[model samples]
Target: MKRTIDFILAAAGLLVLALPVCIIYVLVRWKLGSPAFFRQTRPGLHGKPFELVKFRSMTDEVHKLDSERITPFGQFLRSTSLDEIPQLWNVLKGDMSLIGPRPLLMSYLPLYTPEQMRRHNVRPGISGWAQVNGRCAVSWEEKFRLDIWYVDNQSFWLDVKIFFLTIKKVLIRQNVVGVDVNGIPFTGTSAESSSGK
Candidate 1:
């Protein structure tokens, strides 16, 4: 039932948002040149690695230096949460789900403590309990705690709430800070004892 819902929502979302994304793609091509999609390896369920997809929200060059070097339009896409739209493909491919802990880079997998690694018990998501709650504004510890909590309490209804919360978060344009490159190094297994477990 969950996979069914994931497929249906992911497919329907991709279909409906295709036209806007086309416009964004053309703009990105004109501005940043080819490869409007950015693909990166991330840990999926049970810490399995997969190519996570997103609309390119950074110049290929910017990626080489830092994501903060992102173009103005790229920043807009990220702040608006549109960069995440392409992950529906990952969903359709069964590499991700519509709702789960957001995937993190493969580099972070080794850093996970036994409890932190619990986040991988389910597929990664485009949006999760942490996203609507605080996103990048929250501390790394808070974020992981939320992720672990989702692992224990996830349900169809919880996913639905997260979906609706995501829409509201996007509309209000709140807590949509960029990925914290220099802010907080992901603490992983060393995360100051996640009390939320």
Candidate 2:
């Protein structure tokens, strides 16, 4: 039932935004040059590996870490939530949902303790409870708690709430971080920094 709604909404969104997506692609290719798509291996349901597609919202360079890799245009895409538009494909492929725990890097798999690993119990999402709450401004632990909480209590209405909250947050540009040319800045970096890089 949730998948049905996700399919309908994601397909509709992709169709409606096709032209804008193409314009972004052309701009990215013209500015960043080639490989207009950024592909990464992210864990899906049950920790399965899948290629997550996103617009190339960063500079094209080898060994450029994320913190130092974001571009001005990429920052715009991210802040406006336009960069994520490509993930509708992931939704269509069933690699993710319209709402669920947001997928993270495959390398972070080992970083999770047994409890934290519970986040992968369901399909990943384009937006979720954590996103509508505080986004990057929230603590890592809080984010995990929200993710786990969503796992414990997700439903059609909850997903609907999250979807609407996401739209409001995006339109108001609330609680999201600006990208630095070199990286995606961590909002609670001092806390994270005390632990380590």
Candidate 3:
């Protein structure tokens, strides 16, 4: 039933937003260059791997990290969340849900504790409990806790709430920049961090 809602809403969203998406695509290409989309392997349902796509917001400057390569237009996309519009296609393709835990990198798979692994019990999403609550502004531990909570308590109304909250967050551009501007990667499990690994 949830998947049905995801599919229907995603399809409708794509249709309604098509023109805006195209404009963003052209703007990203014009401002950022080729590869208008950014693609990365992300863990999906039950730890399955899928290529998650978003608008390319950073330049292909190998010498500089992602934060440094991010242009003003890129920041605009991030602030407006135009980059995430492409993921509606991922949702339509059955690789994601409109409301669930946001997928993380594949490398983080091994780092998850048994409890944390429960997040993968359902499909990943473009926005989730963690996103509405604090997004990148929250600590990894808190985010994982929220993810697990949503896994345990997921319901239709809950999803509806999250959907609206995501809109509010995007409109206000709150907590859009979760990590540091240096593009520091997410550190691993707390234990690993404690061990300096």
Candidate 4:
């Protein structure tokens, strides 16, 4: 049922937003140059590897930090979430779901404790409970807690609610500031103790 919904919605979304996506693609190429898309391997269901794609929002400056590498156009893309549009293709490709735990970097996989690892029990998503809840504003522990809560309590209706809430968050650009990079470093055990979990 969930897969069905993800497929249908992602297909329709990609179709409806095709022109806008093209424009964004051209603009990203103009601004960022060379590769207009960012592709990185992320852990999917059961910790499987998959290529997660998004619009390239920063320059290819290996020495520079994300803060320094990101341009005004890149920040606009991040704030409006236009950069995330490509993930719809990942959903259509069965690499992700429309609603589930948001996939993080593969490097984070080893950092997850047994409980945190449960987040991968379901497929990764373009948006999820943690996204609508507080996103970068929340602590990593809180985000994982929300992710796990959604893992346990996910239902069709809950997904619907989260879907709408995600729209609201995007419209308001909630917690979008400083989102060029992941908010806090999750040091596995240290985060657990700091959050008193």
When summed lDDT is taken over every stretch of 10 residues in candidate 3, the lowest stretch is 175-184
lDDT of 4 at 156: 96
lDDT tens readout by residue for model 4, 1-197: 89998999999999999999999999998989979899999899999999999999999998997789999999889888889999999999999998888888788888887888999999998888888887776777778889999999999999999888888877987642222126555666586464576
Q: What's model 3's lDDT at 169?
A: 86
lDDT accuracy of residue 186 in candidate 1: 74
lDDT per residue, candidate 1, 1-197, as tens digits?
Answer: 99999999889988998899899889878887788888888889898889987888666664466555688887788778888888889999999998888887777777777777888999988888888778766777677789899999999899999988988888987644334423556756443354444
Question: Candidate 4, overall lDDT?
Answer: 0.85
The lDDT for every candidate, in the order shown, is 0.80, 0.80, 0.84, 0.85
Q: Residue by residue across 41-69, what tens digits does model 3's lDDT show?
A: 98899999999999988999989966699
What is the TM-score (0 to 1) of candidate 4?
0.92
Per-residue CA lDDT of model 2 for 1-197, tens digit only, reads: 98898898889999999999899999989887789898989899989999999887778666987647778888778788887889999998899998998888787777676667899999999888887877666666667778899999999899989888888888986633222212332233243443544
Task: Give the range of the ten consecutive residues with the poorest summed lDDT in model 4.
Answer: 175-184
lDDT of 3: 0.84
Top of the candidates by TM-score: 4
Clashing pairs in 2: 67-182, 67-183, 67-184, 68-182, 68-183, 69-182
What is the TM-score of each predicted model, taking all chains together? Answer: 0.89, 0.86, 0.91, 0.92
Candidate 1 ranges beyond 4 A from true positions: 62-68, 175-183, 189-197
Rank order by TM-score, top first? Answer: 4, 3, 1, 2
